[model samples]
Target: MTDIIDLRSSLANRVQRWLAGSLDQMSDEELLKLVEAQSPAETIAELLVATPTRRAADDDWTDLLLRGAEAKNQIARLAGGLLSSSQAAEVLRISVPGVKQRLERGKLLAVPLPGGQRGFPALQFQRDGHVRKGIAEVAKAGAHLDPWALLAILVDGGAEGGTLLERLDDEAVLRDVLSRLAGYGEHAAA
Candidate 1:
């Protein structure tokens, strides 16, 4: 338990360091707006809105760091259910490069791991050594969204019913689910 606590503290410290410069640049009003946002995505959207012009050189690093931190938080919340790329590759009976290529092609979804690695959710693969049916479609659908946001959609059920991940066996249902998630993303962006 103490080790877990220490790990959490260490992770938090690293995230704080990554975010420090961007947070430091925010005005009081922007900071207050971020505080008022309901979720991390909303907070990040608010921050981006406040500094649209900050996409220049140095600030680009801040944006990447923020995204990486969000991915790390999402994976951490999964409680070790995610596998490292090497583990995923072994499970899939493929090389690490193949696993990475699948991720790059949006055939598999992954969250950013701490230390600049990527973690694939174990739930996406069956115990029999096969990728869940329709998962590729869902991943392709969510390719434009942040990895954390995509994971949320997969894990949390929408108004229609079960989670996207849970419905992967039904291709038609998965399509509907993916459409609903895409709508949510559009609405959020607007």
Candidate 2:
């Protein structure tokens, strides 16, 4: 009886793993069909694991987590914490000119990508270690300087302070950023 129960348990686990979602090892079309057939929760679970590469699975999982985080973030944004250029400057702990310099140098993450992209989601500056620049901080820290400058300085890093900016310029960075952003969009629409 114990042997039979153990066999059943093993069988159930296999089925759950198989039914969880489409395997990444499959072709794109096959994977899409599997994903499309599954419910969102199932899809999320499958994406959490069951991929060929654990590394790839981790990468994908990070993406999904980011999406969920961004959703929570959207609610936060609606509650009114967005800062303007000068306001953001104060948040970053930098001069307004420095903020302007970063913007002019195309270092800042702009809401709308170049080429006049229409109605895209705003990039979450909060996630890039800019949470300290929130309204609460602005209230506490005094609003004279941009708080986001603090975040910018931190993200910029290194002796020169533009490495993060350069990394953001990479095509892969844009794709990953846009992908995570798009994931949030899907959840919002649902």
Candidate 3:
């Protein structure tokens, strides 16, 4: 009887994981739409981190958990947007060594690539052949965070609850995101 129960449990877990994986295969646009329709990243994060004053409804809890998973998947999507060091150097009109110096100075962000190399995020570059200054500010301010965490905060955070990258041109959103990045952006008071 116990063996039968254990077999059933294992099967159930596998089925659940398969379902989640299937849902995670949505296009980035579709995933963002679903996540926004249910809850913004900030709200989901706040709820996950904050101690509850009362019992949340079961549906609410389930939705919150699922939204958190969706956010993780979104971060994974951003991984494909990474640029090789040489590629980044070309984009910014700088030498590869210059790019490395910026990384050491917290003026740029990079994620670990296979074989122990770094890949800069392409999202930070602008149309005029310059990198976004705000990314450097956020990196410098949020120096306490790991590179991947910093990337998530940059691409996913905004005051109005839209993806920060979507409003890269908005002065208000830029201020709000910087102020909110580490509970304080670069311009925030100590």
Candidate 4:
């Protein structure tokens, strides 16, 4: 454990030096643009060590942390059941472009995977190799929402009295639940 801790410390110091060198090489405008493009995880990690700015209150930092944790948890859950686009295409016996088209048309659901690629949940397909019924309708209804949010509704239980995954076979129940979720999304957007 001591050796592990020492190794981690050494790695962290190296990273800190690397980041410092990189930041020093960037123009102010470039630095701002790079910061703007950072993912929530990267932003959160930076904020943990960053000096509090005059524009941001302590409460604002806390809120950012909470939001970051939520995003992290969502991503972890997504990765747990995720299939790469290629894997999904293979499973569906469709071309990669076809898989992407399905996602774009809301015929299938997907979320942005960690490395800037999309990941489709395995639950979206049936054992018989068909897209699960009622999912497209749900996806269409929740089209305004983030794909990750739609995925959370489907996988996480107790929102509409139970998990949507188990109710996918029941068109009526699934649609009803999805409708309610879509309404929530719409309201939130409003």
Instruction: Give me the candidate number with maximum lDDT.
Output: 1
Expressed as tens digits, the lDDT of each residue in 1-190 for candidate 4 is: 2223544655566557555655665567656755875596866455444423323224455456456546645653543467788998998999999999998888988877544787787777887778888878887887877777777767666545546755677867786767677577556568
RMSD in angstroms, all models? 12.9, 19.0, 16.9, 11.5
Q: Clashing pairs in model 1?
A: none
State the C-alpha lDDT per candidate.
0.74, 0.42, 0.64, 0.68
Cand. 2 Cα-lDDT = 0.42
TM-scores, all models, native as reference: 0.58, 0.23, 0.52, 0.59
Instruction: Kindly report which residue stretches of model 4 are placed more than 4 angstroms away from their true locations once superposed.
Output: 1-80, 159-162, 185-190
**If the candidates were sorted by their TM-score against the true structure, best first, what order would they fall in?**
4, 1, 3, 2
Better of 1 and 3 by lDDT: 1
Candidate 1, residue 54: lDDT: 52
Kindly indicate the candidate among 2 and 4 with the higher lDDT.
Answer: 4
Model 1 scores a TM of: 0.58
For candidate 3, write residues 39-112 as lDDT tens digits.
56654454333323423235464556456545544664663366778988998899999999988987877876
Ten residues in sequence with the least summed lDDT for candidate 2? 112-121
lDDT of 1 by residue, 72-109 (tens): 55544552367889999999999999999998887887
